[model samples]
Target: MGSRIWKSIAFVAPLSGLALLMGFGEQIDEGACSGTLAFEKSRQLLEERPEVLDIAPGSFRWEGDCRFAMQGYADVATAGAPSRRTFELLVALEPRSHRWQEVSFSMGD
Candidate 1:
């Protein structure tokens, strides 16, 4: 009797938790991936690094919770030099509990 009751609770507990999750649609704090988010972040980066003239983020897709992929190019203007280039871009970004941060990136690859 004890074993049977324990088994029933084990099976029902997970199902109940899943039901609660599905009940509150999109209530979880886990962020979502979207082009707007990517574009805004890129714009913020440009502001943070004034040396960068522009970073036009073209497209974005979610890789997972660990990061979202951002595809874009950067136009850089140094103290006495300015250059603009477009190339294949791949970048990884991690979302913290409060904000997102760039982890790794590459261009022309």
Candidate 2:
């Protein structure tokens, strides 16, 4: 009798927890930054720069209500000599109707 009761309690407890989590799952704000037009704009911006070394898709993520973080690469010119190297690029974006309202770019050493 004791073993049977323990088994029933274990099964029912996990199911009840799962039901609560499903009912009140956290809302991720991925939708606000997503749409067909937004994606097209992003693609265009990525293509315009000839200095870009490479880009990792899906690297852009929301930072807050109107800001985002983007990571990629850009070619950097070395000082005192004629040499070029790839730098880790980090940027922030502010959204404007299907386009970025503001963008700040930087290189990480």
Candidate 3:
């Protein structure tokens, strides 16, 4: 009976460790800068701005904590004319709502 218990423990330990590793690996992958919940929320906010006509898929970089820096090209309406401009945004995840909020935004030619 004692040997059987030991054998079961030995068999289960490796499996438990492997499961933990796989779970953490997925979390790391999902936490990447671009394809995350924060990025999607930021994109939605940018699209809703009145001056923004269109936005291209942007590059993203982690700004530590729950903040991110995003840069991309946008077609913006300026003085009744549509022009492509480079834009930068700083966004942070709102912990309470699990949503993203724009911290700062800028655009220039």
Which has the greatest lDDT?
Answer: 3
- The TM-score measured for candidate 2 stands at 0.37
RMSD, every candidate, angstroms? 10.1, 9.5, 5.5
lDDT comparison, 2 vs 3, better candidate: 3
Ordered from best to worst lDDT, the candidate numbers read 3, 1, 2
What is candidate 3's lDDT per residue for 1-109, written digit by digit as tens? 9999999999999999999999776554433334386678778888999989899857988898689877999998888679999999889876677667899989878
Candidate 2's residue-wise lDDT over 35-79, tens digit each? 344444554565566654345544665656545555554443345
lDDT of 1: 0.61
Over 42-85, each residue of candidate 1 has an lDDT whose tens digit, in order, gives 55654576656777767666666545566667777756766765
The segments of candidate 3 whose C-alpha lies over 4 angstroms from its true place after superposition are 1-35
Best by TM-score: 3
Misplaced by over 4 Å in model 1 are 1-35, 79-81, 86-96, 107-109
lDDT of 1 at 107: 48
